[model samples]
Target: MQSNQANDQWFQSAAARDIHLDQLKRVERFNGRAAMLGIVIGIITEGLTGAGIAHQIGLGALVDGYAACRTQFLPFCF
Candidate 1:
């Protein structure tokens, strides 16, 4: 927006100023809550299944039975 070239002070100032600790705390708090909820859902699902959830889904379970052999095939390689 300047007529001539200028330094990037505006963007730098926007990045550096720290007026919002409470907002940051709220963001972190919500993130933690979401993660905890996910864990609880995972635990409940595990309880529903007779066998416990493995660290990783077993190879046999992931590929053929997973989304008709198309979707989860690539993720299993990782």
Candidate 2:
């Protein structure tokens, strides 16, 4: 009887672990698909706007400011 109980417990533990792993795999696949979709959307946006992702999101000024400061040797450009 004790051996049977032990086998059942072990089987249940293994089944639980397998289920957990499957869930993790599904989540990872979803994340990968989402990332790919985001990249494609970003590419399309850039094509339409003629600007990179950073500029589209309003970071162009900061980047341009830094470049200007570097070229002009400004003491404080931040």
Separately for all candidates shown, the number of backbone clashes (residues 3 or more apart, or on different chains) is 0, 0
Ten residues in sequence with the least summed lDDT for candidate 2: 69-78
In terms of TM-score, the best-performing candidate is: 2
Candidate closest to the true structure, highest lDDT: 2
Q: For each candidate, what is the lDDT?
A: 0.63, 0.92
Candidate 2: misplaced stretches above 4 Å? Answer: 58-78
What is the TM-score of each predicted model, taking all chains together?
0.42, 0.72
**How well does candidate 1 score on lDDT at residue 6?**
48
In lDDT terms, how accurate is model 1? 0.63
Give lDDT tens digits, candidate 1, residues 1-78. Answer: 573324477665666665366678889999999999978876787788744445224654654455555565454543
Task: Evaluate candidate 2 by giving its C-alpha RMSD to the native, one decimal.
Answer: 2.6
Tens digits of lDDT, candidate 2, 22-73: 9999999999999999889989999998898778889998888888899986
